[model samples]
Target: MVCESNSTQAAARQLGINPKLLDRGQQAQVVAEVGSEELALDPEIRALYAANKWLAQEFDVLKTALVFFGQLTR
Candidate 1:
């Protein structure tokens, strides 16, 4: 579980798989091939990662709201 922002890429590289394919959710095979090795990031890194994920979800919600309002105006 290499938990860097580029974890998928790193895992793909470590397992000699293509990063592009891995990014498309080819993780199960990668995990099967490499087994699970946990990442050892600091608390700050973990917190930042969690914050980024949350922000992404919030952005999606905002986009949906904009689309909804746009449809209502039309």
Candidate 2:
């Protein structure tokens, strides 16, 4: 299936197969071939991205508070 997880007709078309038939046939192969390592990594990658987003939001809030408190000293 070599698609890295994309099973769309466009993926099949790129491989030179007729698009309509490719969908049903390759689906099973793709699922079977996916490694356990990949399955484990997917969640880890998603968690890292989510954590990064949260840290960025928190830093922005802290920055705004710092500015507001600094102004109070004047």
Best model per lDDT? 1
TM for candidate 1 is 0.42
Clash-forming residue pairs, model 2: none
Q: Which stretches of candidate 2 lie over 4 Å from their true place?
A: 1-41, 71-74
Native-to-model Cα distance after best TM-score fit, residue 18 in candidate 1, in Å: 34
lDDT of each: 0.62, 0.61
Worst 10 residues of 1 by lDDT: 32-41
Residue by residue across 1-74, what tens digits does model 1's lDDT show? 43335887788899898777665464444344344423213445446656887999999888889888895342
The parts of candidate 1 lying over 4 Å away from their true place are: 1-39, 71-74
Taking all chains together, each candidate's TM-score versus the true structure is 0.42, 0.40
